[model samples]
Target: MPDHLSPDPLHILHEVFGYDQFRGPQQAIIEHVTAGGDALVLMPTGGGKSLCYQIPAIARQRAGYGVSIVVSPLIALMHDQVGALHEAGVEAAFLNSTLSFDEAADVERRLARGQITMLYAAPERLTTPRFLSLLDGLLSRGQLALFAIDEAHCVSQWGHDFRPEYRGLTVLHERYPGVPRIALTATADALTRTDIVERLQLEEAGRFVSSFDRPNIRYAIVEKKDVTTQLLRFIEAEHAGDAGVVYCQSRKRVEELAATLAGAGINALPYHAGLDAKLRQQHQDRFLREEGIVMVATIAFGMGIDKPDVRFVAHVDMPKNIEGYYQETGRAGRDGEPADAWMAYGLQDVVNQARMIDESPAGDEFKQVMRGKLDALLALAEATDCRRVRLLGYFGEHAVPCGNCDNCLHPPELWDGTETARKLLSTIYWIKKQNGIGFGAGHIMDIVRGKKTDKVAQYRHDTLSTFGLCAESSEAQLRGVLRQLIATGALHVDAAAFNTLQLTDGSRAVLKGEVPVRLRASVSAPAARKPRAGRREAKAASPAAATLDAAGLGRFAALKAWRAEVAREHNLPAYVIFHDATLAAIAERAPQSLDDLQGVSGLGVKKLEAYGADVVRVCRGPHG
Candidate 1:
């Protein structure tokens, strides 16, 4: 048995996982679960949520309990997680469709012999009778240690990433009542959290909720203006040569934008479910293994990815709601380094999102909940105060202005647009009243701005008394005003009627001047782009790169190159073998011996045995 495996959480954490200490509630959660207590953990992505269960698995297994079963949602997630554990010298295996029949049987034989520490599988496979029997065998042999359900929010229909298969996971609690189970998710609002607890039958479980704030990720939502150009500029100025994910709303848009990005000399790849499964896997593999590859994808791409060096997450179109938005943007800056959550949304994004909700086949109650979530996201986007505060407040957590977000740094000016809003609403009200029809955003904006295009002339809206009433207001300003109105429920987007605007009952307040309308003034983006990472609380491209000396920089580069070659030989992501933080620490310290390497963080016994000598050689310079 490995020396790190024991009934000691801190010993396993440092000796196996190679971390110096626990963050937040990790130690507490691990100790609780290891002591046979059920838990529900809500830690943010990159917040070391995995450690909450992983440490317990090591401790419990060493205590002569049994193999821990981890119910993961994605095949990619399972593959990488198991690989990482193997690198740490822990015996972890995953049983998914990717394994051959004989290979799976071999794993089953080893599992029966109490050889594996942690085993990962999808919920669908785990719920099947054959796997259940195998689990029964393990239970009879005192080999079933615990159960870990990752992405626990999927069990709830209210969450954005609901999976019907996750509902079947209630069997874990019912069948293995004696085994402690921990349900984990990084993103869940109050309702989703409640639903997860209810559906998973974790009512008796201890709840561990960590702060949702990712202060290292700078939040910026720009008003959409040629999103492709803006995105390219943002990448070029801020994150050139860094890996990122760009999300679009549709499959067609994903492919087109990917091609366009590639044309602009970027290493971009498109990923969506519309593509062949083999091709999708290939793209995902390349994204995981290669550096500086931008993945232009839909919501389908980023569910359980554990890539830790993603520098940014850009959105060409807005997500449907706050949960989805929070989960998606949380993918960036997993290394605790400065990263960006950049998005470009405009009137169409709001309309498209609202239209999807209105047109969905869900029940009215579900639709109402979805709408409320969307409104919160819009409020975040339109907020002039701290974006971080607005985001965390949605999850029922409060915080002071994080001096890191774009809003906190720039301090957008808010203009009172009460009169302008009335004019815009009057156009909708009169058009619906006179013509018995609602008009979409374009025509209404045109009428308000006094632009007599071909559509406006054909509609014959020039003769209306409200036509061009707010000619002084720029189209951008009015569009901003329109977004706020929709967000506030003063206006509704009728999806059945070509996304036309109609006055809601809430509009009466604004029309009667009983409510004041405040809007974020339209500010032009800076023409000449400069790096924003130099600002306070922002980080460099990678951890500690900016602060390293010249010799340290050279040593860091050599270590990275060596790590890349080894990663290719092992067919794993470089970060999985050794993260940039670990390499940077090694370079900065210039460790001269194996004893010296042990003091650096992220250097466990197995890793030290595997690569410690090579790292020391790299640090000693070319002659050595």
Candidate 2:
């Protein structure tokens, strides 16, 4: 029918997706799926992951007997994908609750006639008898191409956004064993990846694990003390008027931070589950469509969102796991420009996160796994070496000092943590043995510091054997030392029982002075997380010229005009395609040829090939 759906993926990739190349392991993945093989792809966000399966879907559909069924997690994502495919002149339709009865019936009729090449349905919809019956009908007619599962990380119980329905996706393979299946996610650790394989019954799937490194995003974690002031300062100093997200652990914090930003004359909005659905959607839409709009949100705000030009992602609270942190921070710099993954994390954030997990309806095993993940995130934050290396190492990738993160930009001075660890562990030990008690971090700290606080006196912890043992350190320094101990696996917290610090077997050697424990001194917290005074001064002194330069330095004013016009026309942010820095870089470099422009920083090879010629032509026009 459609020329037997060429087995060559590169041809199909160019013809259908209008792309001339494959990224990373996309070609290998496409071949695996097209050969009726199962695959799990772990590529980063904006890494051209969709092309892996989408091309194969078209190729299989052309072979005369199949329609590819895509199971997506988000309704909005389904709509956006289907709309994009339709615009590319491909036949695609999605079925979800958002569709009216008439629309549903029309899609159903189209399915029966095999008019649709690809169909997208949410997991909740797929399990319904109505939709399963429709799928059976299509398969019986030789109209089932393959199954493509998006956001496969949701299938893992350990993942941040695990969906129970995803556990049921195994039915697709059970019912249609011969059909190819592909499970794709941009974020999944080794454990989560294994869970995806097991839960989805993809034992035989060819796993494609790409490098989990996002080199363009600069990672930094500031020890969060006075988070509100820290957050305000960070947002104002580094990312003022740029598209960024300020994530809080609570909705109340989201509202408060949004109000703070607004009071500071910023266009900001609050987004959380507590808000009305319509209002949340409106705020999301505005954030997506309006440049310079800051979105203050809790963890629930971003999933399956396709905004490409977000420049920074600041975490006002620590995310629960490295997977969650990676996924959230991965949102920034999707355009391959320099972006900030700034976090203001403190010990309280850990307790609050643990409280949330402990209060959840999950099993003890689940809570333990979550706690382990949180511990891993803490290790990353406390690491004194290259932040990128430590982060990528968690995801099983090796990296060098990225020379972009704050730590890389300003390397911290590390000290021997061994003596400090010994003192801290010894303090925990002596306090436990003498008092027959395991206490919280604060009480233990007081005992170590020999402080006679009221609470310390109430517990008679002030006169413990370990009293004044760590008197050399201040209250804050002792807390930092303890945090590093916990991160290093020398200490554990028993959340199920009373929350108490328990020395692990790993701490035994340190307690016995059999081995040395070393730690890096924590950096001084950033000065109030505000915009750099120099940047502010630059803007203040050259406001007019800066404005004009942001408009492409007067070159291609018409392009700027067109960008603004089209941004309004499409209800999208003008910066979504390119940031002002990118534009300025292009204008200043003014590469007359595409080859020349490819050398400019921030212009990835694909982007250079895609828009380089046009940008150069615009640079040479009379608008300059």
Candidate 3:
């Protein structure tokens, strides 16, 4: 059969978490960690990755004089985590800017006395001399157990949330060679995984990678002519009152979109590192504690926020790479509920995203890799048959048709791409032969369609044998065909070396008519009639209707009314005190007992202890 089981740690998993069995690779991971072997865990969002480290920390702590040190990325996240650990009766403490000097000293005192089981700190704090000295002391006394790195992907320069301090964590090994290190991240690709290992010095660590599929999230990609209008319609219609995040490629766009949504009367907030720390904190707090408040942000927000009930995540601008898009969209529906992952992508979005990499100061290899990832994301966005299938395929996983996603629920008709791909590949080859220098799509299309443009004539490309071969097709059609060819690996873009177009081994089969190539027609094509403006707009809710209940099912009319009245008095956005979800949950689970109230999710100790009675009274009667 398999290796041994029935370890004492397995028993503790059932006893502490109320879970009888491990999901995916939990048993193997726990066994590895409990045995003091370092591990690098790569799992997707909502994949129970935290339990892999948390359970092992507890087990190893109980086994002997051990203390698990957790290095997190966010202060607010550390607070929530340490608080939860305290409620579970785990001796946990965090050192960050939030704590006073005396309080920090108290935690250090506890650590020296072997009174703390787990400690959380930011990477910046973890690398400090004082903290290292303390760790040195702990190591000497044989009280240090293991080092767990959360958000491990942040250590990679190619990752979306790269942090410079993370690269310095190699000292953890140099300082304490005996402490086991477990690095964990919810999303990472092969390239990112390698970077994580190299940067963290986890050369000898075991890797536990779980499946990257998020079946509960429904993915949809819509190509739009007027992106702002489509985004408004989507937010208004699909995720009106439910909590969601809107990602923008630019800080200016983030601000403008947030303002536009607010002008339209939606409770939308802008979040980016450019904003003041206080404002960012305020927006983050509202997003976590309140429900239905949309946060329009750049890549800075939503790293480790534990608010699990985000109903949807929308992308107003295309993300930098697939990993980024995956992590951003994965933030939605984390509570195992129905959630929508929607995006409005266009040709300009693709160009702008590529241009961003082109402008970066990174090496040529890094930029090329980044472009490859971007192209992959674009291909997935342009796929018609099954979005989920294409998404999981990138991470090397198979999936049945996920009925929740847009394409699986509404499969698109595929067109034969043999002639189209051959025509495009011929154009690229003909252009390269005719003019040694590469040209962008517009100029290349002009030459192919016999436009006789000034640039095309200047290069004498009109006389090429393959010129005007696709003159029957419109400019948009030819462009679409070229894009599809590039996306499907029949054509490749070499942006770093010379921005040249080259064909892969797969393109030869297509040229020989040996393989059937198909692609989804543009959703906004003339043949595919545009969705009625009135209907699209009608799908969206009015400003008044955007503030609904947790499920967006309209049970919080009175609660919203009360919030509006209170907000007007305080001149706030009805979410400063309590979120709609919190209120609706309070309304639904009108806990008569203190234990019941404390058990309510999102109702942390501060809220439960401060406003528990008031909330109970409100749920008990009309005036409460």
lDDT of every predicted structure (CA atoms): 0.89, 0.76, 0.74
Superposed model 2: Cα runs more than 4 Å off = 1-12, 15-17, 354-364, 430-435, 496-498, 526-624
Q: Which tens-of-lDDT digit does each residue in 1-624 have in candidate 1?
A: 655455788888788878879999888899999999999999999999988998899889889998999999999999889999999999999999999999999999999988999999999999999999999999988889999999999999999999999999989888989999999999999999999999999999999999999988988888997889999998887777788999999999999999998999989999999999999999999999988889999999999888888889999999988899889999998988878999999998999989999999999999999999899899888888888999999999989998777777777778899999999999998888878999998899899889899988887998788888888988899888899999999999999998999999999999999999987776347323334564323333356566777799889988988998998898888899999889989998998898889767888889999999999998998997
Error of 3 at 559 (Å): 12
How high is each candidate's TM-score? Answer: 0.96, 0.84, 0.77
- lDDT by residue for model 2 (1-624), tens: 243246477766655444557878888888888878999899998787877878888778776757899999877677667765654456899998888999999998988887888899989889888888988888788888889999999999888889899888889889889888899998998889889999999998898988888987878888767777777776777777777888888899899889988998878899999999999988988887666678899988888777666778989888888888989998887766657888887666666666677778989998789878988888888877788888888888877787767776777766665676777777778767877878788877777778899888886776666678778886666667777777766787667657778889889877777765555456546423333222333322112124344445556344555556655664455544444455656666656777666545444434455566777777777552
Best by lDDT: 1
**Candidate 1 ranges with C-alpha deviation above 4 Å:** 1-5, 454-459, 523-541
Q: What is the per-residue lDDT of model 3 for residues 1-624, given as tens digits with 9 covering 90 to 100?
A: 112112366665654443457889988998898899999998888677777888888787777747889999998888777765654446889998988989999998998888888899999989999899999898888889889999999999878788999987899998888999999998888888899999888899999888888876778887656777778877776666667888887889999999999998788999988999998998987886665789999988888866666777988777877888899888986655557788877655665665678778989999889878988897887777678888888777788777656676566666676786676677767777766656677776776677888887788888887778778777656656666666666765555645556667867877877766666655542132223222213323222233444434233454456656655554343433454455656556655566656545445444555556655555555643
Instruction: Score candidate 1 by lDDT.
Output: 0.89
Better of 2 and 3 by TM-score: 2
Candidate 3 is scored at a TM of: 0.77
Model 1 — TM-score against the truth?
0.96
lDDT of 1 at 120: 97
| Model 3: per-residue Cα lDDT at residue 266 | 82
